[model samples]
Target: MAFDYDLFVIGGGSGGVRAARLTAQDGHKVALAEESRMGGTCVIRGCVPKKLMVYASEYKESAELAQSYGWDFDLGPFDWPKFQQHLESELGRLENAYETNAEKAGVTIYKSRAVLKDAHTIELADGQTFTSKHILVAVGGHPNVPGLENADLGMVSDDVFTMREMPKKLMIVGGGYIGCEFAGIFNGLGTEVSMFIRKAQILRGFDDEARGHVADCMKMRGVTIHTGCSPTEMEKRNGRIWVKGSSGHEEEFDAVLWATGRNPSTKGLGLEEVGVRLDRGGAIEVDDHFQTAVPSIYALGDCIGRVELTPVAIREAVAFHKTVFGGEPTKMDYDLIPSATFTQPEMGTVGMTEEQAEERGPTLVYATAFRPMQMAFAGGEERVLFKMLVDKETRKVLGVTIVGPHAAEMIQMAAVAVKMGATKEDFDATVALHPTMAEEMVTMKEPVRTLD
Candidate 1:
């Protein structure tokens, strides 16, 4: 049967937009529908805005560092409104770029939500229906606010960008990267930030030593972290929000943020009715090639519950295009994927943690923690950590974890080495760049302890 378009993509997120644009560029008719902004979460409200805020928040310390370095200046109070205005303008520019690129690639753009009506049919929010040869769903996820009494009084990550003013006292819930990163951001921005984490440590899935270093740094930076705690209820009282924790501790704050987690934005997409299977967490079930249970329908990115990063989504989109249209089947590589948490000090990691590597085989761990030259010279107690995990038998570097200034930047290069299966000897053979925090990665000649 003839179709209205060769492909219909149900989202305008990084993944969806890339897939739609690539397919259209291949000379196939492609159409994309987005319920909200063009750049989806990452460009619209997630990483882009968050990173900008992180930069904005760091100026207070930057000024102090400058003063310690013999530069004279007074750091003024953070102007939220001015920064937010610029942020909004930047986001608008990015959204326009996404739309312009898609249109230039000859993809039809629809500013409405699209849902599946059948294996090959999609219906827009306006009740307009269209049939396609293939359908791709890349709707991303949203911050999850736990269901509790007066939970609506609390804001999620998405609500942070829209806040008219920064809260004087902020109570953040959850221990994941979102919670920790925002804790650092708000605290740096001069908010009295308090974190209620259900886990023993802030970053549960990260390396134990690295997370410990981060938690210590966050506490030293004036973030009151209450580990082994979670909010059981929230209520508005006397112009403030009061939260009762699972540990029976109660606190009041000017604002409450629930960064517990995120759920895939899959509701009302009509996937179940169209014979597409969904996982227990409401994520769409897709095969290795990103093809859904129904052959004509495919889903990727956060909605599929895989690696929920923007780069991963774009890679999946490229892989999908190559597999379905380019006649070269490709699968996304999930190994050696580097990630970072933008807390006060920051952390960047690629490959297995000491715990994970030990579980696989005998491991050798090399680690160092010391105040860097800049921080030490400024009379600051902040320390940087560099750790490398190696396989005892194979001598291959199993993982690299860094916690300190530009950890994210350092990890990108470390990821390249790890991806190439560089061994500990290869790292050792590289000459150390003197007086640099990164030099420690190459200079750790002895294992702190070998785990058999």
Candidate 2:
């Protein structure tokens, strides 16, 4: 059967781009279609831009810390427009890089929206259709804003990049990492920030103790955290958004940002019409190999609702290419995947949480919390928590969580240990570096408590 291409990707996200590039590099015909920018969410709107903003927000504290170190200077107001301009420029550069890489790999680039016409046929917005031997969907996901009065009046995480000015008083809804992160960001940038969470704490589904520490740190930083509550209504008047809280309190703010959650972007793609199985969350249902029920079609990344991380998606793409094109079967390993939340204090986590470990079997918990030397000497009240969950029977480190500065960097190394199935003895046997927060991970020899 003759086809227009050997592989046709319906997205230009990390997963799709990697797949297209790898397939083409493997001497196969590949074409990738993306209606929007090439880098997809992580590069264009999500992680990259968000981390830049996090860095920008941290400068306020950076300046304050410098003052404590005998530096004298009054920082000026944050230049949001200037930062935004620079951010957009950088995004443009990245988008161009994605396109360039794809073109260099001999993959055709279609700057158009694509839909499934059948298991192997993709129809573009321009009324052009192309057939491929196999199809891959990696369109990614979008922010899920619930239906509410004047909901459009609020902004999502993606819209933060487009904001022309910083809000004086910002109301962030939801208590997830996205919401908590922006709370820290806006608060650090000198905004009177308030967060409304339906749950009692932010960063739900994470280690309870670690999440509690993060929420406490956020509160100490002057973020007005409203737990056990949410916004019921939003109204606009006098250029301010009036939010009616579930507690029957109404307040107005310069802007409202919704970081509630994300839904798989499988809308209007005609997946069902073509016999692609979709999960209840609208994510494409695929097997361990990422092959959809329709063997000719496949999906991965956030669109499949499986470990929606940029690196994970890229790995999945690599494995998919190795399996289909290179004739080597491969499966993605989801265990011990390290993740970082860019909040004020930051959080790095990998493997199971304490609760998750306890549920599996007998677990020994090694936990420590103390103010870091730098912050302590500088007369700061901030603290860091380091915890390790180990299997008592096997002595294997089941999970590791750190909440404090440089946690993201520390977790990367910790993840290696967890992935290698390093036991508690291995950590204790290692020599500790002097005057460092990371040394705590190795120095904690005895279990604070054991769970059977």
After superposition on all CA atoms, what RMSD does each candidate show versus the true structure? 0.7, 0.9
Task: Estimate the TM-score of every prediction.
Answer: 0.99, 0.99
Error of 1 at 418 (Å): 0.6
lDDT tens readout by residue for model 1, 63-148:
99999999997778999999999999999999999999999999999999898999999999899999999999999999897878
- Which stretches of candidate 1 lie above 4 Å from their native place? none
Clashing pairs in 2: none
Per residue, candidate 2 scores C-alpha lDDT tens digits across 1-452 of: 89999999999999999999999998899999999999999999899999999999999888888898899999999999999999999999999999999999999999999999898899999999999999999999999998987999999999999988899999999999999999998998889999889998889999999999999999899999888888898988899999999988789999999999999999999898999989899999999888998999999999999898999999999999999898899999988899999999999999999889878888999999999988887799999999999999889999999999999999999999999999999999999998899999999988999889
Q: Candidate 1's C-alpha lDDT? A: 0.94
Error of 1 at 69 (Å): 0.9
**Worst 10 contiguous positions by lDDT, candidate 1:** 143-152
In each prediction, how many residue pairs overlap at the backbone (N, C-alpha, C within less than 3 A)? Answer: 0, 0
